[model samples]
Target: MIRLVKVSKSYGDTIAVRQLSLVVNQGEVCVLIGPSGCGKTTTLRMVNRLIEPTAGRIFINGKEISRVKPEQLRRSIGYAIQSVGLFPHMTVADNIAVVPELLHWAKSRVAHRIDELLRLVGLDPLEYASKYPNQLSGGEAQRIGVARALAANPPILLMDEPFGAVDPLTREKLQAQFLRIQQELKKTVLLVTHDLDEAIRLADRIAIMASGRLVQHATPEEILSRPTNKFVHDFVGTDRALKRLSRIGVASFIRPTHSVKLSTPMKEVASVCERCHWVWVVDDDGKFTGWLDRTSLPAANSVRQAMVVGDRDEITITKNATLREALSRMLGQGFNSIPVVDEEGRLIGEVSLGDVEAATAKMEP
Candidate 1:
């Protein structure tokens, strides 16, 4: 956990950061985002003591970070930057092992950590371990920078536009990978980025800064659904509603439905059909197969035989997928119902058009 209390920074005549106070809970990703010249970067730097605050106090896990020696405090926290400042001459493994080596970890332990971190960030230790930073792609270099920050397994991570140097596709991949890693590791993260979409996609709580002051601090949904002021609303832009959808999931819209397994006979399928337009056909493993037309089932012997064997291209979303993803799939395929599945591909439930519409309606101003 990290906290900043009425913190401010000034460079002689200019104020780089205003009286900013904020908290980043343990295992939460708090993103700082705003236009250039805003204090987001300054606020982040103050936390690591890279830029000492001229006023107020900062604490980490209840201990004032300023009380600790700057080097010691920094060693306890992981830090990454946009340029990926990897040593050009050092091997990937060596680059990642810098912090652990500084802490005087055993050679064997450092080696093991390097291997683990490389794999954790989707890089092959055996292949990349011996390569220099120049030999890697921008995305790979960014991942290495992240792996280096994480080498010591610190509980707190500070990232400043860590993926900004990569191409859009690579940036997306790294963002997704970082998010997945955060989900598993759950480190307290303070990330600074100028990209609003990035902030919405990755932040557990986003702090929007402006003119050296925090304008808003709220969850992505709350920020989008309920902007604190005109500045906040304008900053989120006209696509705020669409961005809100990107954060919601199909699971939030799914409701209990009369579903039948593949083994269910045609008669049983017909019986449970009720007024529903179609029956969902699922395999023995409970994975969705296709849909069965109720009208056509009367002439068939079994549900499987009656089921439309067409490409199950019908929108299928995982439990972790967002409502916007489901909506995108539906609009792309022109389908009204989308089958929801678990990680193992087992059918869970179906989300309908009415469900999505209702959810969107509830989010309206």
Candidate 2:
């Protein structure tokens, strides 16, 4: 929904952005990232007219943004920054109500918007509404800044290092929460950050910038697997392979197999294991119970009585877990295979070493 065509920005003798061109599709999250002073932020600011481009055209939806009044254009787009910049004198509720009030919304509507935004960002409105910015933590204030920007339900969002000021743990939480919110809201987003990890985690498409120019624009997986040049490869770093795994899920590699019930006789367990080295055991309810080792079956009565069940001693990958998680668990525990389970701990399938190896090979350059 946003497009920049041959956009460039200069401040006296220095060029902040070169003739950059890019398009952020409707509801896509596009991240701009690179080294310091590479014009990523400048490109982001140009979209919202925070830093007017000296040359080239910009568009939001279909109309040229340069043709619209600055104030009108900005109000239609949400903006957030590293500093958060919440008004200390205003209550959290009032701070979030800023944009709505500016747009001449009724007091009741503003109040309702404030409450809805707070809840949307995972904050308790009743508890946080009356508090001033000074009374909140850095993370809380940052959340308020986002809520304020989104108060008008703008279809486009411009963010510049929005999570940079928070601690690492808080930053991760915020990124995850923002991703969840984005999935639900689907606003066309243009975010600027120098952190590659952040770009990989949050962006649908990453635009790598260098020396005031757009170097490459591709999906996170594409960029990681097939960087266009030495500059792009070095910028993405050597850990790109590991990062790619974090984008795929365990379900992509899971293999279906036969499962044994805990109530099954030891002889039956051994018979089931005749073709395989091991058998996964489940309870009467089909919840993952444990596994039956071929060597231990002949010495016991039932699968439940003979099963080796001390925490199962088996690594498990949740369906929602990334392939990186599965790989890490397998490598860390030195296991040949790992179980794949659902959220409720029911076994669904198994992931083998071969599965991980094949997936990694497919993603390699």
Candidate 3:
């Protein structure tokens, strides 16, 4: 755990941070966010003593950082920054090996750790180990930077815009990888980013600041649903309530699917439709194939003639999808309800627009 007591930083007459106190508990990711020159980067630097605070004490795991040597203190904590900051001359494996080698681990242990971290960040060690930073793409280099940060397996990690440099699609993939890695490693992380969506997706708690002061600090759901002040309210934007949907899982709102196998007779399909206005058609394996409505039942004599053979991808979403995504899909397809499927495309349940509306009503700020 990390704690700050009345921490402040000044540059002669200029103040970068003012009497801010915050805590990031064990196995939590606390994101610091604000506008440019809002002292977000300064606060992150102060944590690792990259920039010393003018007043107040900072402690990590109950040890005050001011009492420790900066070199030793830094080696014990991991840091990753925007622009990647990789040594242009270094290979991927050598970059990841820097810290472990500093800690004087055995040669074989360092070699094994290099491979372990590469795979952890979703890169292949055998292919990437000897590759130079200059030869990699923006996304690949970012992964290497993350691998290097986790190289020492430090209990605490300080990341300053770690995923900000990549394109949007690559950034999302990197964020997912970060979540996967965090789930396994459970490191205490202090991350800085100006992007609210990224913060909402990744942070366990968010710390909002303005003009070098702490504006609000709370869980993402609370901050969005109940902003502490006007500064926080506007900072989170008018879409705050909508963003709350991302926090909800599709499984919570799932309803039993009304479906029939393709081999079923059209009369039987029409019979199944009596329980519901819409009936879904699936293969013998139970994979989603198409759907037909009760209104269309009288137009055909056989199941093949009545069934609307359409792309399943256009009509189905995985059970792992969030309510926000489900809502978006429902609107796009002109659907009041849609089928939920497992990884293998077998229909499991359905989610309706009503479910999304009910869940969203409770998120008003």
Model 2: how far is 207 from its true place, Å? 0.8
What are the per-residue Cα lDDT tens digits for candidate 2 across 1-365? 99899999999989989999999999999999998999987888888887789999998988999789889998989999999988888999988888888899998888888889999988999899999998989898889889988999999999988898889768867887898899999999999887887898889999999999999999998999889999999988887878887787677688896679988766677778899887878888777777777887777777877776735324666676667767777797676777787767788988887877787788756
Cα misplacement distance, residue 26 of candidate 3 (Å): 1.4
Each model's backbone clash number? 2, 0, 0
How many steric clashes does model 3 contain?
0
Q: What is the lDDT of residue 337 in candidate 1?
A: 73
What is candidate 3's lDDT per residue for 1-365, written digit by digit as tens?
A: 99999999999888999999999999999999998888999999998999999998899999999999988988878999998999999899889999999899999999999989988888888899999999899999988988888888899999999998889768867987898799999999999998898888889999999988999999999899889999999999988767888778799899997888878888788778989888878888999988887888798786667788857767888876678768877898888888899989999989999999998787654
Q: List per-prediction Cα lDDT, in the order shown.
A: 0.86, 0.85, 0.88
lDDT of 1 by residue, 1-365 (tens): 99999999999988988899999999999999988998877888888888899999999999998889999998879999999999999999999999999999999999999999999999888899999999999899999999999999999999999999878657866887898999999999999998887898899999999989999999998999899999999999997777887777666677666567779966678778866878667789887777777888768888767787534434567766667767777787677877887767667887877777777787867
What TM-scores do the predictions have? 0.78, 0.77, 0.83
Give the candidate number with the greatest lDDT: 3
lDDT of 2 at 74: 85
Candidate ranking under lDDT, highest first, comes to 3, 1, 2
Between prediction 1 and prediction 3, which has the larger lDDT?
3
Q: Which one is best on TM-score?
A: 3
